[model samples]
Target: MLLISAAPAAAQDTGLNGMSRDQWLPTTVASDAPLPDDATLDTDDCRYDAELPSAFDADALRTSETAAVITVERPGPGGEGMDTCGTVAADGVDLPERLSLGSYVLYDVDSGEVLAAKDPYGLYRPASVIKILLVMIALDDLDMDELVPVTAEMANVDGSKVGVGPDGKYTARQLLQGLVMNSGNDAALALAGALGGTDTTVDRMQELANSLGAVATTVTTVNGLDTPDVQTTAYDLAQIYRAAFQREDVRTLLSTETATFPGYGEYPEFQIASDNGMLYDYPGALGGKTGFTDNARHTFAAAAQRDGRTLGVVMLNSTIAAGRLWSQAESVLDAGFDATSDTSVGTLTGGSTGEDAGPDAASAASAAPTESSLSSSTTPLVIAGLGVVTVLLAGAWRLSRRRS
Candidate 1:
């Protein structure tokens, strides 16, 4: 017979550690991006058709412009190293020795192993990193070739934008590239409106985030310019990137260095450059997203491939000056590479750093069950099952007595 303890009293839903959830959940996709004009709402809708199918079939729930979902038939070259589930890596691993960051996390693309993470799950403002989610989700919902009209709201969106205005139009592809390559807050909002507008799009994002196990995270905006409530952790940001990386289209967008969108009238077609400085500085750098605000400081997430391994890293709420995030991430990349002495990221566990409780506590909670809990259930059950039935019966009797 099994015994059940009274469920622990529900603690208030606290932020990861003691950080306030409010610090994490901002209201607008871009807190600083200017609001769209209300007068042009009906005639000049900025929203894209996210639910359209590949065929533009009205009967389909998604739009035809969305990229067709492709299943990864097999793990990439090295398996996605997800092996860092049970414990953290040792400190001595060859991570760049000098780097200061408030929070950081790294994961192998193929094997899914979290090579290293610092304050991985601590909640912080994502700033523009949130746009990656908006673009990915919109791509899944809408058709890539479908034309989406730009509107005044999206054109004039504040913060960093591709500068493509609302009067012009673009296919889903151009907008997505603009969104990722330029870290366009306007592109994020326009996509949100196209997908279904701010409120509905955000709700859907929350749903997707939960399905992907991005706990301790909340999204209030598509652009992540900052809102009172929009927040996420480095761990959750990695989770979002992991999910996006699984899609070829999303990967293509992130890996791209430059994008061109033709202009209307005297507005010369623009060639916006990528915001990920490391892409220019580091050779193996694939691509990344950048974000910042007084409230958030500097935040960045990037992925790179070298010597047969791909590493994704995220830094959040760093107190350092601007541009330091990339340097810190570069260090993280070095540390991860050093951690794996083996060539093949070595079996998801990524060379298995032998530290006892090494990973950030939150990642450990999400990746696997604790050893103590497992030991308590396993050894006792085995002992009760093997002890000639007398002791097993006694244990059951004891449990019954306690319940009475």
Candidate 2:
């Protein structure tokens, strides 16, 4: 059964009577503009053309230009009866009603059982969380000790950077640290250049994700920056994180709270701090990635171990506030840990059919958004639609654990 704590008087005054203090704050983007006309909504590549879901109000989603058409398909038999598309289990663990998130998944690290999730297959901008795929691809293709020279293009990348200049030179290992620890866009560019170029690196990353059963992930940018075509689902992200966690090097880097990178050429030495607060605030935090863009609000993926159980959690399109994101993730992990082994509401397929797989394995994938005519002007509309659906169904699903 669901349990809700009584909100303080102040919370009620703020329209947060049954929510956490953090819930009082709005999402990173909050606007009340009118929904765009149906004629203006792009649907050329949308798989589903029927009436929009009842829970979502077209007017609510149209308020922001970020809205675009989002299609979530039910998983096939191989999906272990889990609704990859946003279906909450009738008897899953109780989740915090106050937690604000667009799409999220909590899974058992060892068993691959989905403990609780909302809009697991709903497509949303990944922000820098996509870097996990890049890290994995880089580790597989390049030697950790290989020195990579930074080029003018690499150093010119926009967004959060590790200050790697055009004259800087560092080993793949160093750049990997900066990529994960600081969400360094420069590190990503350098690594991408080392891997051949952005196109080649992104292609390989996509191939790897498909082979791993992350069918809902599409890589357009090496650093997980917001792109109209780049997208991922919380379900796919959890799969990616679980796969990355298997690598000792990845685990070590993610678990690291702080590290020092020596200077190269004219660049000075620098200390990099992890953006993932769970490493310091939450016990057994295995480290994770953080992502954000104007198009993609706060996004995060992390893992933690307790009582011999390792749990992985992913939250996408959340508030930019770190406290809110970490707190929400911690709550999911707590529920996952408290849940019994049989409490699984679903399972993450990891994009495989339990047989030999290759790049084409995901050609028939159902969860990932298909390439469409969605342009930057209409991206916000899709995001707005997804956000509305998530809000509508967030409270509809029961979180009670099933009793044998």
Candidate 3:
């Protein structure tokens, strides 16, 4: 839903495509003592067992919270998008490099166990993939049958469009389908209007981000367009994606290859093919979202099930300089599926130690109201009054298209 706590960006450290060495890893909070700045934190004695290095340690993270492996050293200089995933593992199993450029994560959706990651908590601009979050909030708040009148402003919105003219109107269900299947900004606009304007919509989205423990995510636009403050992390994306996939309706939306969207006014109904390629190309691809911007490059979050294991992956600041963004994810998933889910680098929900998550006491979950108390003080009026549902959401890749 938004970005903050500016990262250190030095010239030599900036990436070929704009990623920088600073990596957006926040280091401290008000209360706890700063953890020792070390390249790797050994988790052999923690709740999960894995050896991965996060450039920085957070005071807010408990020992178990640190179990979520955030980064690994880049094996070598990988171009903006060169096949950073590399080749077969030592055992000849196809998997991603221990260190790949940019930020990406692979995890078991059912258990929220992180399998593999590179900069999993590195905050970066999310772009269009944020709509997946918007839908999660929308599904719970908006009445599916409610018709939202379109506006010329919506049709004229910059970026991608599902072509809804001022004279055309759509049910919340229809607009959501367009938003997911086509990565339509116009649909997001109309939906935002239905939700009571962008400001209110984003506030709700942020609240949802808080509930799901996506602390790094900050929603600036309901449509997931590029904005200076938009941000999210690979780790948080997995959390949001897992929550969204829990709903059967969302599973269908993510998997649907194409759908008929109503045309407004003089426009005729049109077919909107899914902008995400993984659904068609990857065997177990259930559904996911894609995003892009010159700054964001390529950001993706999707889920697939193999051998009954439902796994989700989130990649940020990815690019064609490597390979098709989807293929990069495939390599990550390939490595993930081959690994045992029993042991994790970290978890999606709370710490495995069954204790507090540490110093960052201001996480949205604590800063904001959750499903357990929608009627409480911090809950949004629209959401609270509905006595509604809950969702976790995420996505993006720009196909002349595409946030929370």
Candidate 4:
């Protein structure tokens, strides 16, 4: 019996042994960076660590090398304040310890082993990487060939746009391409409309998040624009990407270098190339999403295959102050690949980390996504054939023992 529980909106825990609730979910931290236009939103206040230690040299690694002081807006490599304070690392593995990143998680996608991480659970605004989730549902439920007309509302969405307007009709696939290739808020809005409006779309996104074991994420926007309540962790992002990348279609769409998007109204058809720099600059790049908002700073999710191994990296609350987002991501990826030791800080777990919805919480989470396009891991958690068996689970998700 595949007995799963209902996941609530709140996260279960951040995995840190000691800290105040506000440290993980601070309500009063003000932004040192300028807010987006006139919008009101939550800020991390440049708080990168939760009293944790990093893998890099504590003495040599400073946010700035020569400057007397570094600010969050322009934090330098090994910036003092920007360290994630994460302690997770592969035993005796060397890392690109100089990269300036707030928090990141590097993991083996094929094996689900978290090779290394820095403040992996640090919470920050998920800028556009949330689009990966939006497209996941669109790809699952909406027909790619279906034609969707652009609305002016979609065209006028506040952030980045892939140029959808009222005058043109686009296939679902085209809108999705714009969403992925251009980080188009317009495409996101259009796709949400096609999937039964913003409310339904956000609901489905949250459901998928809960189903994916992404306890640290809470969805509030179709595009990853920051809202006070909208947030995610690097760890949760890795989980999100793991589930999303399993779809062969999502992989092909993200890997696309350039795609032609139809122009609506007065705009002419234009080409939208992959905005993620890693796709062009890094070898074995599997393609991923990039996002930025004044508050979010920078967030990235991408993976690559090298030496017969596939690895994914998720960087959150990052800034160009240290190194470029992709550059830091590349460095972390390299560090993860450098580990010859089998030691892992943590391993990705099956989804369904929540209170018992009815019963059988363990049984429900044991089963991975069953979609034909989605592949399940053969990782010990046996994938039972379709059947109807009622399982009585004894432990709740929080009470159950699980890998990080």
Return the lDDT, model 1, position 288.
Answer: 79
Q: Who is ahead in TM-score, 1 or 2?
A: 2
lDDT (CA) for every model shown? 0.55, 0.62, 0.58, 0.62
Worst 10 residues of 4 by lDDT: 386-395
Candidate 3's displacement at residue 143, Å, is 2.5
List, residue by residue over 234-280, the lDDT tens digit for candidate 2: 77788778777655556766765555566767667855556666765
- Candidates' TM-scores? 0.62, 0.69, 0.65, 0.68
Worst 10 residues of 2 by lDDT: 395-404
Candidate 1, lDDT over the whole model: 0.55
In candidate 4, which residue ranges exceed 4 Å CA deviation?
Answer: 1-85, 352-404
Q: Which stretches of candidate 3 lie above 4 Å from their native place? A: 1-94, 97-101, 350-404
Candidate 4 achieves a global lDDT of 0.62
User: In order, how many clashes per candidate?
Assistant: 51, 14, 28, 7
lDDT of model 3 at residue 389? 28
Ranking by TM-score: 2, 4, 3, 1
Candidate 4, position 167, lDDT:
77
Candidate 3 lDDT tens digits, 1-404? 11211233332354332334343232222233433332222222321112212212221122552324333233311212211332212222246433223667677778776666665555566777778868766665666667888888887887767678788768777787778777788889889888889898888777767666675577778877655455676666777777776655566666766555778667888656667778756888888887765456567888888998898888775543335567667877877788743555556662211111212323422332223322122122332343322111112233332211
Single out the weakest 10-residue window by summed lDDT for candidate 3. 350-359
**CA RMSD per model (angstroms):** 25.2, 14.9, 14.6, 17.5
